[model samples]
Target: MRHPHTRTTRRRVLGALTAGLLCAAGLATAAPAAPAQARAGVPGLADGLALTPPMGFNNWNSTHCRADFNESMVKGIADLFVAKGLKDAGYQYVNLDDCWALPQRDADGKLVPDPARFPHGIKAVADYVHAKGLRLGIYTSAGTRTCNSAGFPGALGHEYGDAQQFADWGVDYLKYDNCNNQGVDAKQRYTTMRDALRAASRTTGRPIVYSICEWGENKPWEWASGVGHLWRTTGDISDNWGSMLSILKQNLPLAPYAGPGHWNDPDMLEVGNGGMTDTEYRSHFSLWSVMAAPLLIGTDLRKASPATFDILDNKEVIAVDQDPLGRQGTVVSSAGGRWVIAKEMTDGSRAVALFNESGTAQRIATTAAAVGLSDAPAYTLRDLWQHRGYNTAGTIAATVPAHGTVLLRVSADPHWAANPPAAELGLDASPLLEAATPATLTSTVTDLGRTSARRVSVSLTGPDGWTVQPASATTAATLATGRTLRTAWKVTAPPGTPTGAYALTLRADYRSPAGERVTSALPLTASVVVRPPAGTSYLSGLTWLSATSGWGPVERDTSNGESAAGDGHPITIGGTVYARGLGAHAPSDVSFYTGKACTKVTADVGVDDEKGPKGTVAFEIRADGTKVASTGVLTNAMPAQPLTADITGAQVVDLVVTDAGDGNDSDHADWANASVSCGGAAPAVRGD
Candidate 1:
């Protein structure tokens, strides 16, 4: 279940004409269908649902019953499933989360779709989805009420009736929640719903995919395979790297319980939520797919960016998740933030992932024999992200970026020439740049395949207004195996460009031995920033080049309380209140361009008082990636502790807050009266 603090505000308008309207729409007056033959129970569902992990969209993470989650929005999602090629990509179900219902059930104990939200009721929505060749999924809790604060009725005691109603209404999937469960036995409650669904499926001849969302509270993996098609193995996932990584760690150990028709779900996909970078999002998608977890998208598809769609529409990666083998990838090695995971495929191949969970790039390596693949003289390595193929003598390795993953498919095949030759591309340049300043960037393309690449060419392109000029030869007549082509370009950000990260593309085009054209591209980020004026100032007054948090936006001159901006009170720690500072949640980083002018940074740091005596956090100040100051662990009971760091000659200064060993619950940290000392005269700083 999602944390109560993050629940969206519920609409309390009760539809007085719900029953009458439903009857008028013929949704309530329809006669029940005859029951079909009964199916066997236990071990797993005999109906053979969810043969592959369910792929679709669920509205809870993005909308959460907000006003936009209405009939039109749900219908629009179904339309996108067709127009955006998602339906063809194997996405089947269009699920609605909580807040789609009224505050209470109708007169006859029937669930009422909030008339304002679903004026035509759920059946109409299901019909529209089914018309688009897609399935429909609905949510309800096992307890008396749903997870939302609105306290909408659940299907606990009315399991059979509710299941029957869903079947009659054309619901093809059910996300059974665990909240408000009233201390009932986990297995018993889930099993009851499973039985009810089976009975309903027989009557309606419609098999509804059952998703057990118990949040891993009762070790559902140990018993849920026989009860539901899929079971959530973790709590609600927040749209941050820390939260995502934590959940991934929790789900990776339960691989043995998942198989075809039954899966261990690690919650929904947060790839397009905007809290994390595109690199991190790609890592999220890659990790989930390799683990064979359900790929229920949790973002508003209508407003998603092209990059989001690219990550979601990667057919190669999706194939790994939907692989008929149904083997969840297992961790082959993990140490010092480097990890190697391998999943065995049905065709005697292996899908391997080189993941970097640390703060820097690390080269992760493994062999085919190590990942359960038979030893061969040479194995074809398919880079899932690059969409290219390479041949190696059983050695598979790549330098993965921080919070990134390199996914590859390894297979020993005699017909390897049918695929494109493998080429690796890289970009070397400072990610941070000043407006209008020309920077030199180098791109290197390496031929890692067994055959040589012919007529290889490389080019760099930036945003529309930016300039990119070749500084060295960008073409090569021939590149032999194990050889690299290095090219340089002078790139300049246009004057007056906004101070934020802009995408740059480094592309390589070459011809394989069989005369097939191959293209490999790498995305790079360049942040244009303004340097601080030559003076002392409070850090909060300056615009941050980048800001990320675990729960919400980083607050200025306040405490991190909730997900909304400016929702925090004053920055209070212990018995003191500081009016000027930063209120950041644990697992946060805020960076500013200092331009080597700032000499030192000072602050009084501690866990914020708003969190009471609950949180434990540590603070660190980094100048140009070198730690200059640190605070060990400070709890809410501790007073403000003064600290200072010399940041002389540093181009960037970073304020980082991390959860101290324990989980990041209520870990709101404050940098009290944080100030930067720069050369020259003092300047006025902004404050609330």
Candidate 2:
């Protein structure tokens, strides 16, 4: 959230100009009178709904329009919400995204639930959810048909009847989408539904939380608060780091428009999706929470891992999101892929997030005074992830891993000394390891509290069947405040371990001055990687360690379209098609492990013709984080440009695509016939 003191001047100028422009464009209008208790000057429903951003489960991201998304699935989700403790964790809504209704309406012009999908009807599903102490949300479009190609009947011209039907069915939330609107004005269309919902709430005594899904094409943040409880500030989010980061950038700048009952929805949570790493998912959750966005779970709970639940069930972080102050976190400092965001809390604390967006670890730091907190001789710094409190002399700092966030709650408390003595831990070692190779891992512990600690001990543990031996002394006695201890461990991955990420835990235990035993455990991920083949190979057939795209999933040998995997045509550039290549959108990065054996990489790079003369993108090839080759800005009108890079002695290679100054719209980029030659071998020639 933007600190009111620091942003007052900028907010006044931007707010006035924005309001004036919106009113002149006829997109802004006088909002209905809010209830007496509603926050003054904020536009939203008077029904006291969505006091905090709604936490819930939505089926669209996990099982969109699938056959399994039926009555059983909906009821199962409600069951999980209770059985898995999500109910206690504050997740209340079980939403059906789309394809839950029939293609046509009944003779009375009322929407009908699909008998095939909802056997006992929508009311039964809502009742099942309500029985579990949760609310039910349903999806619809403001046009003649829903967004899905199934062409489900929408509530555009039948807003009153649809809203009434939803109320009668016990629907507690409605996600109104944009599709096939026939050129209707966005504000006029959404306002009609808002009025209808209000009337239904009066008659049925069931208020529904409204969600506006216009894809931010009309700058919904400027006019949506009066019409919806939360509004999407960007396009639909794909389960990738690039998509999440792009959406975060779009939503973070609109902080002033979100508060109390109204929020800036950057789409739903993609925490458990398989596309991104757990570290990235944690960042996704942390950033969303700090920004005060909705915490809608977008994964199947039944199939989620313990790690996924750990990220979702973080109540300390959730408290920051549900903070009654309702302030969205704003960037206090951002540069070179490092960002420091701060949110003012109601209890005179500030939630600070040190985020590392780059591809390497970075030390991000900020002062408490910089985050709108009053200065003091000492302050309390609570690590939300670690669930520990420490004393700091106003400085909040952390070495955040790539695509990770360090979330801390800082407060100038007079009783700071009453908290337990805290120690900060750090691990200085590469997280990647080859099987059966012994690597030395160093762990550092620093006393950051107000008092000294005794009997400090540190240990490193790996997965079962792996060897972990101490390389240095792991115990210390009588460590004073501000003291540091370093320990080393020789760890070896077992032979034949799978080439994937595994967990390692570094733990520290100490006796506080108050005789309380304090323990801190930090989890690290170790990835076992296998080098590429010795001969030349097409990158499309190789396994990328990680890949992220701006719009959708990265496609192999196809154009990067606006959908998930395999939803694109053959890779095409300037009307020319290629059979072997990578298709990715701008703001994309695909990394492969070469193990320092690859000699060179060659490709024909350009903006794919699928965008049809609209995209502007630049292609880059990086070897071990250093740029080895690049292309000037290329557009869809340009032919494929041949490029080659010397990747000798580079362990990893990255294929990158970036938007050229302009936005990322239609930036479908391709690396046609991309291949890497390894071990000084001759390049493999392919006929296309």
Candidate 3:
């Protein structure tokens, strides 16, 4: 059972829905016994259903229940699923998400369909689906409520009864969800339902596909095999590239756990969701197909245009999902945000997807040598989406679009064929980082693509005063590109080392992958402030700036630091600066830290300082020009005063201090020596 805090909340809700139905149908009415043994020749639920890619239509991305759902929508989609050849293409299930069930269970302890929309009853809906030569899929949860706490009588204590009811309704597929089940033991909670589903299937003699949906909690791969067929390995996916990539990257390391009977479900596809451009959607489909994920479409099938229809109907791409090899792709290489390599099936051929995750377009080419196929057979290539043939002499090459991918099917050209030996060089890290002082340096070794290096040496550097530990010189072995080696270093900053700015550097060695050792570095970062937890405002600002996403960090130790770090003091009229990202040059508003009860004072501070990506250095002051506060040079430091500013009962306050080059009073002009604060009902500066 997935709690709301799990990575992907919505998918867990679906998992709960599936499990709850089985329990409702009467399995495990009492406490569980030991794990049951399988009867000879009895197929696992996953084996009987969902043996291939799970074909279904979900209501998240394309619909989201923003509008009133009706039988027309359901029947229309069922008609489209068949009319559009999707059912023939192997898509056979239709599942609804939240908002379909009523707020209360009926007298029979059975969840009643909504009277307004599901007037015909859920069983009637199931019959409608079955009449179309398709299967009916319904949603529910392990908890007593749904995602929004709407009532939908769940399987919390009545697993057996609920499972029996769903079985009686002729429900062919169940999407168990996870929601509102917090404060309960997740594993035991889900396990109880899994056992119930097993018992329900045995008693009813009906096969129900078990979907474990805890948003990958308790590491689904660790226990999902015995519980469900397909486990949601990540949060619900949105109709954007980042959402897709984030989910995909999370599933890479869990590849070994996926097999023919089980899979790493990376949520559903947003192919025709209208949130992304067509090119991005094509890339999205290619990536998911190459990953061998469940191909559940979250689009309004009835409205799918020819383009959408064509992409979904691409048999070549679909072949990758139904590959006989039954192997899920794993990420072979990653450079954080730059590139990735994933492998899958190519209809008896091999499909490799080389992706460039950068902002600008990147040309990525790999010889059979780099990816371990040095002397493989001559090959024919075809771009899956383009449906065009590609002829390669020896090397396969393509320019991946920005935030895009190139899917290639590799097989013998028949003109030339040969077997090649696999290349050998590996990389691994052990306890990658350990305890160190505030400014200690650490190192990790790398293996080169080549075997040896004539002058193999490594360097450790990051932030200010990074020192190589003990001895810095060693006659090291030639490090392969993916090989691992350790380096030790210490970071020592002199008293004069600035306290505000931090540094990040890369440790590089003069070692090349193929054999020629060259000095290339890996990047590292060192910071002065406490690390902010992810998603906090401070971290969001910093991460955005570091990515050069139009934001820059301020120089805390400089004159312009006042605005970035200042506490509210003497009344200022116009504006006060806090942090500057974009909109600095553009007209903007400022916030002030006013003490608890500071009364009113009318004034405006003319914040005229503007600088680099960090923005301008200026300040805001009271109209009378008596009180002055300044936004100093760009820096990353928090002000000595509280962030909020207050101005009450004060007639005059001057907040602007001229930049050093502005010819203002030198005493206030130099930010390095300026330490301004207010007393009493004033905002006080604790540090200079």
TM-score of each: 0.79, 0.80, 0.58
Judging by lDDT, tell me the better candidate of 1 and 2: 2
Winning candidate number (lDDT): 2
Q: Name the lDDT value of residue 602 in candidate 1.
A: 89
Per-residue lDDT of 1-688 in model 2, one digit per residue for the tens? 1111122333334345444443354333444443343324346665678888999999988998889899999899899889888889899999998899899899888889999989899999999899888999999987666777566887767788899999999999999987656567998889888888887888899999999988787999998887899998877777878778878888889999999888999999999988888899999999999999999999998899999999999999999999988999999998756899999999989999999886655567788899999868778899999888877766677767778999999999987876766676777645667899987778888776667778999998899999989999899997776788899888889899888767787788998777888898766666678777777788998877777788777898888876678898999887788999999987888888888888999999998876555788899999877899999899888899999999999988999887775546678889999998886575554323
* Highest TM-score against the true fold, candidate: 2
- Compared with the true structure, model 3 gives a TM-score of 0.58
Candidate 3: residue 224 Cα off by (Å): 0.6
Per-residue alpha-carbon lDDT of candidate 1 for residues 194-311, written as tens digits (9 for 90 to 100): 8788778878998999999987878999888878999998767888886787678888988999999999999999989888889999999999999999999999999999999999
Evaluated at residue 254, the lDDT of candidate 2 is: 91
Tens-digit per-residue lDDT, 1-688, candidate 3: 2222232344345556555554465533565563445322233434455566577777666776555466667778888888888888878878776667777777777777777877787778878888999877666676656665444665676666667667667666666666656435666666676666666776778666666666765687876666677888865565554445556667767778777767778788888877665666777788777777788888888777788888788887888877756678766665523344545453445677777654334445665444444354455566676565533444555445445677767654563212121112111111112124333343444332223233455555444344435345433655433444554455554444432334434434453333433444333323232221222121112211111100111223222222223321222112234332212211111222221223332222222233211222344343222233334442222232211223444322222322222111111111222222233333433331
Tell me the whole-model lDDT of each prediction, alpha carbons only. Answer: 0.82, 0.83, 0.52
